[model samples]
Target: MATTTNDTTYTESELEAEKTAGSRSALAMARRGAFYLSLGLAAAMTVLFLPDLLALLVMGWTAEAGAELGIHRLHVMGIAAVVGAFLLGLFVQAYKPRERIASMWGAFLVILTASVGTVWFGVGRPEEVLPFLAVTGIALVAHPAGRRLLRRGNSYSPALLGLVAVAAIPILAFAATQLSMSSSTVDPHALDGHYVMMTALLIAPIAYGLFAALGFDGWRLASWFAALPIAYYGLLSIAFPAQVGSTGAMWGVAAICWAIAFVAVAEYSRTETSSMLRREVGHSS
Candidate 1:
């Protein structure tokens, strides 16, 4: 009886170990899938949208378009900035799938919401929306599943929390502005310039802030966010005063954004260097 019982116990242990190993293998596969999907989507979006930015750049330089066209160019640039921020998040999620699982969520939500909104509103071709919907849906499932398998703890730094708080100002203001614009019965699609501005005002801060809060890199997005307003609203306003008028309030907000960007970059660099040094030390030891 005792010998029989020992044999059964050994068999059960072996089965349990194999089950755990198989689960880990599955999670690894899911994580890789999430990474490739996120990156491929980013590349696809860039390919899709790069033409718009390039066309605007060519027109601005070759034609020497006046204030009317100049403002339009700024609008295109703002839209590019927002897209760039989303791409950055995707890149982070791709490179560090485990560490930035939340980033994958952010990227997935952005694409899914945009896709659904476009389809529902008849603003985009139904066929065109299918790819985005399919990719994000797969990621939404894979990323969270993989993250659950890893079961990592969340840590929030004080500085990054502060950054989120600062970013909320613009985000909230942008939301209110969007509501006001909608109330006025203005056609959002017809005015690309205003659409891009409001979109940037809402998207950049929220996306980057979420990234920072989740312990992913925030500096790149922060720099992009700050650069748009500073370059388009502050500096370009001087060159094309009639088209992009300089307002005291705009400049003030731009300055604040610049400060936030600088701090984020500095903090990220410091932490990254420290981590690299620690890895080297561990390897040496």
Candidate 2:
């Protein structure tokens, strides 16, 4: 009776172990399948939209020609179509969270198409037009998607910070030019000092975020340092709008700073989550 009982107990243990292994194998397969599906959807959406995008460009050209002949109607339908695709993808992804990346990629492609359409419709130096389109397109597409991707524990901090810097540089350069022009006649000292200070404040978060993303503890500490100056200036502007000269420009700078800070925080959170997971694994082992 004892021998028989031992055999039965061993058989049950083996079955349970086999079941656990099968479950793990099934889960891994599901993860791989999800990844492939997302990639395929992204690619298929890009291909399907290409022809419509081309048609939009052609329509934009027609509209531009018509405007020259005193017939003024905007070829905004193409723009609407492109925007609609993005909206549709967004909604679909909202309902199906697993497909978020695929949807974001789809929306990005639509934005790229619309940017091309804009260049085709607008009467400007193609060189000038393309750069503007590319910059704006990249910023608008990247910010929200980058935010989402980073939130998913993905290591997009470096790229996200780079995008913010790219978006900010042009604005900072334009602000500097405007400040220079205004300073030529007005008391240049006060304005110049404020401009320099604000520019540094704006760039500080970006630098810190980049450093943190690159795995530097000091960079993480520096982000807190950067935030204080930004907050101080932000409050000062609110209190003394006249002193700031351009509330709009200051607000824009503040927004960029906040974006940088948010990215830093998200990256830190990801690091902590990884650390916790590692600790749990060590304990289990």
Candidate 3:
């Protein structure tokens, strides 16, 4: 027979181990929650917006037939591209929630930024803003949000930084032009949606690239998320030169070039790092 001298007794290491296990369990659930939430949101957004994309594809830009309709279609396509890029990131996060935590955070940033922009501008209906706010809250509860932002070992490639700088020029120019517009310049009816699109255009690339550059494992994947939306703007401008003007077309071309360069740099860096790691492992053996 054995009896404990104290009613309860536990070593410090045992307590630490138990606490660690609990933390891991919570993180695991959070990751799973992030995955499911991302997937669900992706599916819903796709269903909601895919029709608009398909309509654009099927009807063609010429179908709009009027200045208002044509401009509205452009706005729709711009918004659609942003949403599509966002959904793509969510799908990526859902694929491997643990490994792709950066993308998960990127998803949260998109929603949060959009929510704030819409609310601040008084652009969308209460229903729209509320849903995004709720989603931002739910996403925040998943994992330790923004913990990676505090990591000290994060590194940025000079080449990638250069690309970001170049890309930002046109982005800043476009932002300035949009912001300078008044009710007299742009149709008051379209102002809200236009501002909302501008927010996405301005925020998505910076947000995704910032997180990806902050020591994320899948910088190559993140490059696509950052580059593609900007590429959309370029493509739109080029395809509708009559609408966007010669200067806009030039900017669009520059954007496309930047996207290509950014992806190439990311891919080259990833390949070089992998090759170096294999060489080190081989030498060690």
Clashing pairs in 1: none
lDDT per model vs. reference: 0.48, 0.41, 0.60
Q: Which regions of candidate 2 are displaced past 4 Å?
A: 1-163, 166-175, 182-192, 246-285
Q: Which residues of candidate 3, in runs, are more than 4 Å off? A: 1-31, 34-42, 45-50, 53-68, 144-155, 180-186, 244-247, 273-285
Arranged by lDDT, best first:
3, 1, 2
> What tens digits encode model 3's per-residue C-alpha lDDT throughout 18-58?
89999998977876677468467646755663665645532
Q: Please estimate how well model 2 matches the true structure, expressed as its whole-model Cα lDDT.
A: 0.41
In candidate 1, position 78 carries an lDDT of 42
TM-scores of the models, in the order given: 0.62, 0.32, 0.74
Which portions of model 1 show Cα errors greater than 4 Å? 1-13, 54-71, 101-137, 148-155, 182-197, 214-249, 252-285
Q: lDDT for model 3, please.
A: 0.60
Q: Write the per-residue lDDT of candidate 1 for residues 1-285, one digit (tens) a residue.
A: 122344554466677787899998897787666757656874686678465554543454344554446555544444444444445555665554555554554555455544544443444344544575576666556663453523323343344545556656855665455434433234643233344243443455455445444344333343343334333333343434444223345654564565456455535744664432112212322
What is the TM-score (0 to 1) of candidate 2? 0.32
Clashing pairs in 3: none
